[model samples]
Target: MTTTPNPTLIYPPKPSILFTNIHFYISHKPFTSSSSPKSNSFTIKCSGNASSDPKNSDGGLKNLLSGIVDERVDELLNREENRVLLDGLDKATQRVEIAKRELAQIEQQELENKKMKEYINQLEIRAAEIEECQKELLEARTLVDEAERSLEVEIEDKNSTMTETEREEMYKNKERFESVKAASVSAIVGTLAGLPISLTQAANTSQLILPSVITLISCALFGVTFRYAVRRDLDNFQLKTGTSAAFAFVKGLATLGGGPPMELEVGSISSHAFTGAVYISENLLIFLFAAVGLDFCIKLRILSPFPIETDVSTTKVD
Candidate 1:
């Protein structure tokens, strides 16, 4: 009797393929048992049809191999191995961060170096300016030294030939000449001071402010010159001072007499005589003034008619 082959039961299969130089197939098991059961999927190495190999077992051998391969893959992906790989990656990232910070510091240092270089350049320029000023000061000092030397040499040449007595006489004569010149100048200045007063006094009454102001200005000029002349002999200075005072005093009468009122009242001849008298009296007063003050200064030991200087330590250079 021909027995009918048991009805082949086929279930839908899940298949997976892997390709490289060779291909692998992963297949889900076929269910043929009357008892309902899920089949395990297994990886199979294949060149051609799986039915050709009698050694290829249905599920047992392939399931065992797939289980071993899956366990090995899971071990590779475990927490310890993954954590070690993550640590290595973190270390590389930290290295990159450190390099970036170092690069920034280096750039900052370079900028600071550039600023320092510029500051150094400015300091060098200022130093050069100071050096130039020092050089100029030294040059000016040398020139002044040379000029003082020349002046001393000239003074020495003038004084060398004269005896002490002769030098004294010469100084006295020079003093006399300077005194007379000073007295004459003072008299002229006094006369100028009085002229405005004289002119305005006769034009009805007028303020004396103009004459006073003129005298003040003239005295200022003379005072400045006199102070500059103080290094000269004390007797000469006293003579000049006394002459100035006396001239200012003696010119008062002339100024009063020469007013417009007097000019109108008196004849030209009377005016001429008055002018002559005033001029003569003014001169006499200046001489008397100089003699009195000179004597006073001498008595006080503030002046000397004959001052003696001796001892020449260094020869004057020409």
Candidate 2:
């Protein structure tokens, strides 16, 4: 095998450079020495023969083959063609900076327009909410009006008195009540006076239908008679006790000026009516005897009171 010798390596001299800062500025920030990012220093680095070194033929030969010298590079910088190319490059850089600034302004305008559109949408939503609230308010007002009308109609019906058509039924009930009451009184009086068992008592003992018949008959007569009263007596009483109280309460609501009295007459009326009815039902014969006793006292002039007016025309509006 044969070995070949390695060629000797040669190195050219390294270049020297000079820098001249054309426009350098110092910032006013405290204790900061930060340099600008843009390089404004003119570089004059070239492999030229201006070095003060010892003459060496081998080094000169290496530099000849390496590159151009510093003098030639300076001459190229001053050439007309190179100067025009540099001017063109500088103009292009300026145009690029203007384009970047315009792009930033356009982005800012687009962001502002987007924010305005969002604000407009919010305003529209608020308007819609306000309109909905107004509609609800109008609906509530309409409902309140309807309620007032219904309440007024109910008040008129409750405060009004009996009509002419109801008087015929009232008279019939009055006739039935008078007949039954008279018979009951007579039967009780006779029994208490030691008279013989009457037909009514006899029927009640034999068949249990007499008492039931009397109860139903009295209820039918009194129920009809009490619906519309010509008088506030036992035969004609306020059956709708709660409703009458409610009517009076509604009338007494206006208490500022001359409103009606706040006294609840229904309590007194209901106490007398239901209590009297219950007392009679406990023992009809005893109730009749009591009535006879009261009548005897009154007829003997031992008891006298104010006269009661029961005619339909005698009713007062208040």
The 0-to-1 C-alpha lDDT of every candidate, in the order given, reads: 0.53, 0.47
Q: How much lDDT does candidate 2 score?
A: 0.47
Per-candidate TM-score against the hidden true structure: 0.33, 0.30
Quantify how close model 2 is to the true structure by its C-alpha RMSD in Å.
22.2
Lowest summed lDDT over 10 consecutive residues: which window, candidate 2? 248-257
Superpose all Cα atoms of candidate 1 onto the true structure and report the RMSD in Å to 1 decimal.
16.0
Q: How many residue pairs collide in each prediction?
A: 0, 1
Residues 1-318, candidate 2, lDDT per residue (tens digit)?
122223452443533323223233323332234665333333332333335464663476467534544545666668777778779999999999999999999999999999999999999999999999999999999999999999999966754655655654565565555445544443444334322223444555546444445433443333232222322333222423332333223322221124233346888666555544443333343333334443453355432211222443343322
> Model 1, residue 317: what's the lDDT?
25
Candidate 1 residues 1-318, lDDT tens each?
A: 121222353431322222223223322222133455544444444332234344654564567558877975565556575657768899999999999999999999999999999999999999999999999999999999999999999987888866777756766675555444443444355545455544645454455555545454444344333423433455475656554555455454555455544444458658756766665455445334434444454456544333212222122221
Q: Evaluated with lDDT, which candidate comes out highest?
A: 1
301: Cα error in model 1, Å? 22
Cα displacement (angstroms), candidate 2, residue 318, comes to 8.5
